[model samples]
Target: MNAEAARTPLFDEHVALGAQMTEFAGYLMPMQYIGIKQEHLAVREGCGIFDLCHMAQLRVFGTSAFDFLQYLMTNDLSRLSVPGMAQYTLICDDDAGIIDDVIVYRTGEIEYLLVANAINRRVVFDWANMIRDRWSTHQPCGESAPRQGIDLEIVDETDRTGLIALQGPLAIPLVEQMMPEGADIPTRFKILATTIGPTPVLLSRTGYTGEDGVEIFTHASNTAAIWRYLLSFPEISPCGLGSRDTLRLEMGYHLYGSDMDRGVDPISARLGWICPADKPDFVGSDAIRRIREQEDHRVLVFFTADDAIPRPGMSLSANGVEIGHVASGTYSPSLCVGIASGYVPTGYSRPGQKLDLQVRRKQVSVVVVDPPFVQGTSL
Candidate 1:
């Protein structure tokens, strides 16, 4: 591990379990407990627990919190009419370039919990603070003074909070076992203020893997206790970043740096669904609208190969001409094949298009398919 790398609250627990740790996004995280394939299969067939403390957690609250977020996020915040509703939204720059994809949980009428990717934590925090400061000081041109600046506060809770995910078909049942009697279990895409044992947590029915699960957020001090309790249920396996990557790849989910970045807009990334046209104008609304009107030069596509596994940076070509490079690639444990996603010319991004993937020494034939290489999971 790098000398500067940070460790999560469960680092000691992982070390004691003989997990292979690696530095990822400035955090020393478990790469694997036993093996990627074993952990991957565990989530597909049963349950897997993951330490997600590396991800950033931000809290936004106050009178103007809704308006502040409404102006910054591409998705409509009004959909969260009540508390405990979680929405996946994209934070974009003025030019509609994706800054980061985050999930916002409406924890209160004027408060929300935003969860962002670990690697983009600082970037998101800085950008949000800059915007918040500017928005708080803006005065109308005709007004003599700025109306009482919208009341708002953005707090970085990354260091003080710990996140854990219990994923798979058995995840909900296992969580229910720990819940107080008569406590309602949060349904998919929802959240609940609940307790496990004596520790209070914000439990949300969400996950990156294409499976049914819940992510629990609690005080950093309570993380290890929760992790140990979850693992005590013999059915739950401790998963690492390796299986997390493979599981998400099989579902055709996008990774921030790989599938998108400051240079890529949501329209070209096949994530336009998150940006509804009926919503009020936002920071990137104008730029996104322009991009949506024009034809996309390159579009993201998901593909699979039978004989060879695709790897990131591998060349993707067609008719003996290079088109693009693999953005994310991995061997799909469930499908028993290699699956990858990359950007290619819009003309060749259809589901049945054939492309050639340069897998090391040989060119392997690949077929562009609709998202989710593996199906019939417990999602």
Candidate 2:
């Protein structure tokens, strides 16, 4: 690990568990604990815990916060009927290119928290602050202004906070035990602010593994103790990045840099669902609206190979014409087959379409398949 790369407070604990460490998004994190396949199954069948403190957390407050977020994100923030609800959204650039896919949580009437990928955290912060700065320097609109006394406060709370994801069919019950007596688990897409023992925390029923889970956020100093307490449950297995990737990939979830990037528009990635056309204007709304109305020549798709494993950069062809290249691929532990996702000509992206995946020098037969390779028990 590079000397300057930041380590989560659980780094020492990972070493104690004899985890195989790897560098990802500038963090020295565990890639696997016992093994990827075992951990993946544990999460599906029982429960698994992951250290997710590397993800970035930002807080936006003040009277202008809601307006600022509504203008900044693709999903409609007004859909959150009550505080403590969470929305999966995208923050895109001016051209409707996805800068990052993020989750926005309404923590209060005027306060929200945005969670961004670790590698794209700074980019998100810079983009959001730029808008806040512009709004702060301007005067309010005439009598029709949305609100009065508007001010914006943006804070990056990544380093000061620790996060852990407990996911699986049993996650809710396990997490409930850790919460203070009489406290209840939050409903799906909802958040709860409460305490575990003496540690203050925010628990959200959101996860990347396509499973029922709660992501707990607490003070960085309290992470180690919380981690130990959770692991005391004999059924809770410790998972790492390797299993996390396979699990999410199995669910057809997009990884920030791999599946979508600053260069890829939401329409091409088939992420238009997050960009509701009826929502109030937001960044890239014009471009996204245009893109949505037009047909994209290429679209992302999921395919499976029976005999060959697909890897990123591998080529895809149909009828001897190069169509696209693999974006993300791995041997799916759950399906017991090689599955991949990539951009293919729209004609070849439909389920049951036959395409050839170039694995090294050999052409392997692959068939387009509908995603959620495995149905996740999220609710």
Candidate 3:
């Protein structure tokens, strides 16, 4: 660990358990514990616990927080009007380029919380603050009085909070056991403030592994105890980033920097689903709408190889013509094959299209396939 890298509250526990540490997003985090393959299977077949305190948690509150977020984010916040509801949204720049993919939850009638990738948290915060400053000086008047204005507060609660991701098919059952009597776990994509073993926790049935699970958020001071409590169940295995990446790869979930960056347009990234068409004006909405008018030149595609492992930055070609490069790739322990995602020309983005992935100096045959290469997930 470096002298400047941030350490989560569970860093000591990870070290004690013999985790292979790595520096990611300015934090010293566990890359793996027992092994990547075993940990990956544990999450697929049973349950896996993850230390996710490195993620950022920002709270937005006040009378106009909802409207403020609607203008700043691509997804329609009106859909999450009810408390406990959550939605996956994209924060984009003025050119419709992806800034960060985030999940926002309505914690109260007028309060909301957004979780951003650790690397982009500060960027998102500064962007929001800049918008807030502009809105404060140029509040719309007359007919736009009730609707187009902003008076919200942003709070950075990341350092004060700790997060744990308990994921898999059996995750719900284990969490149910720890909840207080007469209190039921929230449904999918919902959140609830509840207590577990005397500690107050914000439990949300949300995960990146495409599995049914809950992310528990509590005070940083209580994370070690909560982590230990969750692991008391013999069926739960402690997993790290290595397994987490493989698991998400199997489900075709996008990682922030690898899959999409600020320079990438959301349409080409296949994240248009999160940006609804009927929403009012938002950041990059006009540009995105214009981009949708034209045919997408390149679109994200998924593929699998028989024996070769396709790694990031590998080139893909069709008939000796370069198409695109791999964005994220990994070996699927469950499928016993290599799975990868990359951008290709629209003509070659269809499922079943054949392409050659350049591995070292050799060309490896790969077939494009629709996502979720391994199905039957709890999601």
Candidate 4:
């Protein structure tokens, strides 16, 4: 790809560590540090440091930050008051189509931080920019009155920060051992600001791997040194994107590009709660408004199989009748079974129902099951 290829901050470390590299979301990232299966187990049994520098970060600050975000996002920002507390939200259009999913965190009294998916980074930025502009224009003006302008700012910290996701049951203990000042790491979803050795890192008690873990964000320059230190802990292992995908999939978490997109509504994605009606307006409120007023027939179903891995786009049939196609499918390491999540006929989405998954040109036995194929106490 020549110079057109973009390298992440850990590109050198990944190569030196003999990681299998791949292009993801326009960035060259390590697909696996050792191997997908081995690394997948590493995070499941122990803990691992993942380079999440490729994700985008935006800062929404000033008095109007809160209200401005509430209008643009689906989740109620009203409940987010405590600093460093983070919650998941969906950005959607009126048609109920999800624009993106983001994590909103209150960094200060009136400031918020939004961490978005890699693929929708640019769209999120532009969306936030448009809201901020509207807020400025609509703000009321009066002397000796509270400032009306919602001072909102979206700062892209993607290039400046490095992220490490330490996931597993042993994550808390492993991170506590890496602290330089002998302070305890945050065990819950709260964010803790501290130094690992001499380098500063913000550890958030959150992860996408459906395990009890911490995802740390730090300066780009200090990533390598901090990564090396984390690896020194006996409980910490190194995980890559391949394992990360499998882990999230096992928990039935939707991957933005695969399980969802502009074409699929949030209801069909089984993420309907992400839409908050209290908000005055958002991108996809109108569509969702109509759907919620009446019973919608869209639903996301979990199909578990024993013989074959359910590949995305595979035909789903009921009594030999084609109904839908698989959106995402993978072998579950934790469950020791093949699992997939996809949109299906609303009538067939019921639990305990049976279906056929055409995997590799062959119909495989499959049964509908509840989400979170693996039980994790983290959530």
Our model 2 lands, by Cα RMSD against the true structure, at 2.3
| Span of ten consecutive residues with least summed lDDT in model 1 | 138-147
What would the per-residue lDDT of candidate 3 be over residues 38-120, giving only the tens digit for each residue?
A: 99999998999999999989999999898788888999889986899999999998899899999999999999999999999
- TM-score per candidate, chains pooled: 0.97, 0.95, 0.96, 0.93
Candidate 1 has which clashing residue pairs, if any?
none
Off by more than 4 A, model 1: 137-147
lDDT of 4 at 119: 82
lDDT of 4 by residue, 1-379 (tens): 4456678788898898888888888888888877878777777777777888888888878777777787678887877667878888888765777878888877789888788898888988987787566545443332233435445567888888888888887887766666765686765657868877678888788898888888888888888888887877777777788888898888888899888887878777878777766555565667877776766565789879999889899999999898888888888877788889888868999989999888776788899999888875444
Most TM-score-accurate candidate = 1
| Per-residue lDDT over 1-379 for candidate 1, one digit per residue giving the tens place of the 0 to 100 score | 5999999999999999999999999999999999999999999999999999999999999988998898789989899999999999999998999999999999998999999999999999999998776656554242234547578889999999999999999998888899999899998889999997678999999999999999999999999999998888999999999999999999989999989999999999999999998775677888999898997578999999999999999999999999999999989999889999999989999999999999889999999999988889899
Assess candidate 3 and give its lDDT.
Answer: 0.91
Model 3: how far residue 8 lies from native, Å: 0.3
Clashes of each: 0, 0, 0, 7
